[model samples]
Target chain A: MSERRTPDVLPGYEPLGAAVRTDDERWPTASPDGRRRLDGLRCHPSAPVWTHECGDLLTPEDHAALDAWTDGLATDPPAGDDGPPPAVLERLDRLLAVVPFYRRLGVDRWEQLPTISRADLARAVADFVPVDADLSRVVQGTSSGSTGSALVIPWHPLDIARDLPLLEHLLSRCGITWPRDPSRLGLLNVVHQEQAFTYASTMTWRDEQLMSRVNLHPSAWTDLDHRAAFLSEVNPQVVSGSALTLMDYVDLGLPVTPLAFVSGAVDLSPAARSYVESRSGTTVLDLYGLRETGPVAAAYGSREGHHLLPRTIHVEVVDDAGRSLADGSAGEIVVTSLENPYLPLLRYRTGDRGALTGAGRDRRIVGLEGRAAVRFVTGDGRTVQSVELTQRLQQHGVRAWAVRQRADGSVLARCLGGNHPALREAFDRLLQQPVEVEPVSGPVALGPGKPRRFASELGQ
Target chain B: MSDPLTDPLDHSVEGPDLQAMIGRLLAIPPDFLAGDVEAGPLVNDAVRLAGVRPAGDEAVRARGLGELALPERLALQVGAWMVAGPPLAPLLRTAPGEGRSYDGESVASALLSFAGLADAVPVARWTGEDPERHEEVVRALCRVLGLRPRGETHGVAEDRWVAVGSAARRAALRAAAEEQRKAEELARRLAEKRAQEAAAQYTHV
Candidate 1:
């Protein structure tokens, strides 16, 4: 799948709204003129996927080729020694100048601004948004939150488009490639806690075909025997889902010879990672990212954390003052997208925390802790994740559930179950908590639409 | 599915109507009904505020005021069931403080059970499964009940003979045949039931 780096020619292959089996073919080398073109895009604090230290191995020729390929892509911007894209900075400066909250804070650059917390955002919701800007132009998306609250994120299409290649690249690291025919790819789409109607297709090549079907609410991980039966029936070539969902598939003892298994949405633990690999034999790739920033870093085959996508976006691990933190030092991840302009975020603090590794532009990401920690004690005396409990809950008709840990260490689950009291008794004994069963009268409001597999005290 | 003799119409069953009855009962004014619906003010309040009349006035017209059809008060009950259909406002007529605790799903499930789609198995014994099997049983009983044709003139002399008639005998014959088919199907699989029973007896001994 190694294709020769080409100049402005690569940009010509801009994602045409479909996953193509190309991008693996050889192309021309990056020319100096093409590099200039890419640099022109970078005129405003923009960083293309090619300029980072992690991309240090990229030849000057490769950089030139990519620059020429993406000359006019609003998303393809040049990387700076540090900080956000110039355009992003300009927009932030403009926003700060006009927006009262920022004006009161006296912040010109986002770097000077204190990182906003979710609580703070909720409190200052009205003041934080631009008043004159038309929200209609922003593409609206919803996330079914773990806290049972729905969040609506308004962004431009370009910001959404940038996330595609990042996901494709992360999938590639785990050996997942584009389907032979993009038109026929069928994913067992998951919308929050419920599974959609299963569709059938004949695509079957483990690497070439992309017709693998998926199931929603990956909580079926508790019963390996049941999951194995399902996998044996569906027989997908590739499987990518939430970390909690993938863990459930592994727990189900299903045969795992998939080309790639991608994990996201929740933090994947080492024990959970090993369990999936051992069970499925598929390399598990952890994607460190968010809805706001797309994918930041993706795990390489070596499982040494995730490799930051060079130049696609600039990364910063900074102190509260927004000063760049040293490698291996923990700080909030701040990003400035060079490509997407619909909602230009300059130094947008990604609420997640992680560290940089390697040196210079070659730095990749190491660890990230986003969601809260939850453990499950297996019958084998092994402590797993609360994700397992949720997975098991899914196998029954329970489509939604939330596990709340009280101060006393007792976990209470508010769920939709036909046999509520019985399930409560059974789970109470299993989890060593006072399981209070409250039968929900209707379908649980699973938020706007994003599936949240794990809920914790963190980022509450 | 065609059994009619043991169906609701055949039996003089005394239970609430499948629709409108419960919702209407829930809508009765607390002071007017003497709070017979619930023990305390809260439950009574919940029921009164429920405001659930019948789905429409047509439903009342069709079902004769549903559960409110007392021996001498059928006319009043029938009048109350009919009303406007929308803004969905007229659908319920409860007091300010009283509202329904039962949501739509609970009401629908209850209705299904009343129609024999769901069985009356006690919660202690219920496994929450095999609703189709229970429905089949109900259907079979309904078919058995339909064996007797409408008697001539609705008179006892004719009705007695109709119950003992050749047509009734033929229906009984058909029922017996169907039952035997079911038993044979079981026998084909459980040929050693007697042996298993004998073994169980020995274990007890």
Candidate 2:
């Protein structure tokens, strides 16, 4: 198939190359309405020069399956017992038959099977993929998790599109409706990072509602003022980002107010949530999930905890020994999800701490402690968020690290497995302080269990 | 180190001939099979007979040999014994007790089957790469020879053999898991590269 040409409406369109166009041809099934929505986003004066090309790439069959799956989600039965439900067990059996990793273990019972950790995925992801899964449609996204190294997650387009309905369900529960409005952007995914994959796409599932992922970092825009101008003009109905990014949005002081703001990736304190809600005149919902596991639960308006979102996921709190902890006991958050066909995770350990309250459809994750947004004070008394440190550490290819700042503002970072001399220099430059780098042999040296990646004693 | 007595092991058809051959092969006195031997001497003998140097005291202490179950400890000893020795094919053909005769190639196969590792590992790997399952192999060897180590009752011997066999099966599964991990790591790298290339074209939120 010939590559789809960029429409002339996007005068700032700058293609990365023709290579991107080979498999990323415009969605053949895109409705005319969807095409117009895409053009509107591209033609907006506030839009950055298009750096790359992409679309929903959802086929007619994928659309049908996604719709059925989304529609059934509301009525789907809640998880059963401490063990996996019958359906999940059946899927596990199928996985054992085809997935090499699970087959090699020869574990038939759920209790006997070992829990999978992020390290396992980072080391050998293909082992978990079923042999029969179609690789033709696989797309990848990198997730720089709060605790570990960046992981490249393989995603099916249908799985990516599934987030639309999941979001809609969350919104509807909060009494918010996202009607098709061409004048306003459907959704805006904001990220405050040194660099990010920024692009524009129409949500084909949501009647081609316009959506885009924009980096809030100043480097992403031609003028620093464009950040506010773009947000003001699009006035996105739903804004999604990490709690840190949402705080940046509030700091931006843009005139645009969305119906709701979705905060993820980091823990959102009540004060911070209230701050964003009051500043933007919008409700802030805390979404708890990892890149490996899609949206698991969301804390909506006045909700005591994060209400479970997907019916296909079974959440459990497991102790260090991987035994299931009773409800109300805080432990590592483990999930068994059938969300992605390409990667069916069984008893996947998320490394986040939370307690499961209630049972069945009423299950909620309480006292959820994800990656805390830690701010490090530099030598000059300047404050820096852990996200920036994460970016720097990831750039150095250092995995499994812990960065701690003493009360005197001295930074000490212990990294596992590799000797990184330049990492200290990188840290020194990032924090504007002389940082000490210690190379350790294993994860244990970083500390017990999952280490807290960032900590500051400066009382920031 | 071929002795005339060991040479005719392949032709031996009687249980007594096989018993004599086993004594010569293991370099133990014929009556020693019926006597109790201390574990230290047995371990040293096995290490010496296998033509491999015994591990240092520190290494042995680190492995906690004294803390391990008798079968597990024996497995380690037997593993070191067989790791470097000549093929057991000739002696195995003359093994008694079950009224079974194994061909040269099938001796290792038979041992592997007895240990529940027939499908999980090849004879070459069991002999080489895997020292962890060596005791299980020795237990299977004893079952074929119908020789219970001296000082142990039949019931005790039988129970230890069962325990070692179970350990071997678990080790075999772990070996398979390791193999899959390596293969999957390679596959994951390739898949990751392809995904990166595809993602370079276009990515989602």
Candidate 3:
């Protein structure tokens, strides 16, 4: 596959590098090679897919509403100041005062906490929560609970509001200026869950009419034609999902073009990165977030990595012994969300392993291996890495099904409908072990909760 | 499976006393409830609602029991047996022999089963009455069965099935929407109150 690598690769893009003056200016600073890649990946007009109402993608009203919501926190651009701003400090003070758990963790400011891990937070949930706080308000949002211990979190409206500006700011860095009307624009979301995908379309939060959801579940799309048709129809300005899912489009000669392509939830392979940029002709921005904390870090000017949203969260990369790792050191990522007071999550350890890169004064997190526990294991006892499996499955025609491993070592693969023999043969050859393939005879089963992509016999 | 005198489940199949029937039902495998945590209440409710009684060789229950049929004679009642009552039974219920297609009975059984398995899920008390929503309910139920509603059986039943399916979905959606609306309202009110307090402080100057 490297043989196919294009000769024209962009030079390193460091958001905090010499080329970028201030962190906020990174969005406007496009790398020459990044621009070229963005130009090359435009979708050819051979396919016609449904266009969601333009109002669904963006709305002026929504922007106005968002701006109004953040008016209280909006501060004048630094006035040449750098450390934590006064407004940010004030917000931090309030968060510390209101969220007793955060106060107990001693995380009063954005820089106070270290990177967090899932295990650390689960322990906190047991101890930190005010004995009287109704546990249900802060619901647990987990991408993978391979271990019975999943991150149980509390939801807070203030937290979501604070996180949005940072997300929008990061998005702007990658050329996705949130149009006043989301419905007027096109969208293709490549994410893991059904709620986020559907919410992008159905829900009227902020009134940004995100009317369409061309949900490309990274592991579900397999046919090149389907992929092409989907991109052609949506013509999204922003193409976002796990890095691997977008690369599959590039791999299959499907259009990889978007004004900005954002990847989250897994480590983006270097080869996959090059393929995506070369094909889509777009700058791929990195998004750092976990199920517990929605959107924490986003890439700005440099393709180098993501910058922390110092307003909504305090980011840290901590070593295993609960000590903070120096910049450029790899360890578990822990996050103390300054926003979510409903169920304040302090020093929440995201299972994903990552490290900060670059030296002092120019530090940012560049290396990340998103959650790997959410992967499927084949009968051969080999792990079908989630990111890789998604690419392979999306390349084929399978969509929307559950894969469960029975206690007896048999695998049950369910599909809404797809070409079975080919899928079976692909899995057989891929797994290198013969396994029984059973076609689901009815509608794929959905329990009361969010369905998982892969499950082991022991239960997740 | 022959009609044995006095079912093996009890010494005499004759009208199972309330305690005896409840005990037999409890003995049924937990998996029969699909490992649902709420299965206890659902089974209890359905049994209570059906008011199963011993009469002759079969349980002397109301014939035309709504729209479904009872097990007549069985050691333990399955999910399918829960729907063997009025209106819901006839449109969607499925007897063991009624070909794999979903009848109202299966849908009812599934709803009852899910109600037992999950917590506070609105399976029994749906809010609306739309055929489209009923169809969605059936589709949702089928997902639980691990079956794709396709072939001739897909969307085969008529108006009643659609109405019932729609009503179920409408109820669920309405409840979800209501919950979301309430949360949003509370958030807004809190923000508003804070803003007003801030304003009041400024005015105090």
Highest lDDT against the true fold, candidate: 2
* Ranking, DockQ, top scorer first: 2, 3, 1
Q: Classify candidate 3 by CAPRI docking class.
A: incorrect
lDDT of 2 by residue, A1-460 (tens): 4232222211112344322543325464667767876777777787765555566777889789988988787877776646676677767778765665555444556775667777667756776777667666777755777545667767777877787777777888889987878788888888765445577877766777788878786657777787789888898998888776788788888876898888887888887898898888888878887768777888997858988875577788998878899989999999888878778888888888989898776679999886688888766665667877776676667777888898878888988743378677767666777688888777778776556478888876
The DockQ value obtained for model 2 is 0.08
Off by over 4 Å in 3: A1-65, A68-117, A120-140, A149-152, A156-167, A175-184, A191-208, A215-227, A251-256, A300-303, A352-363, A370-460, B1-205
Better of 1 and 3 by TM-score: 3
The candidate 2 chain A region of ten consecutive residues with least summed lDDT is A4-13
lDDT values for all models: 0.39, 0.64, 0.41
Ranking by TM-score: 2, 3, 1
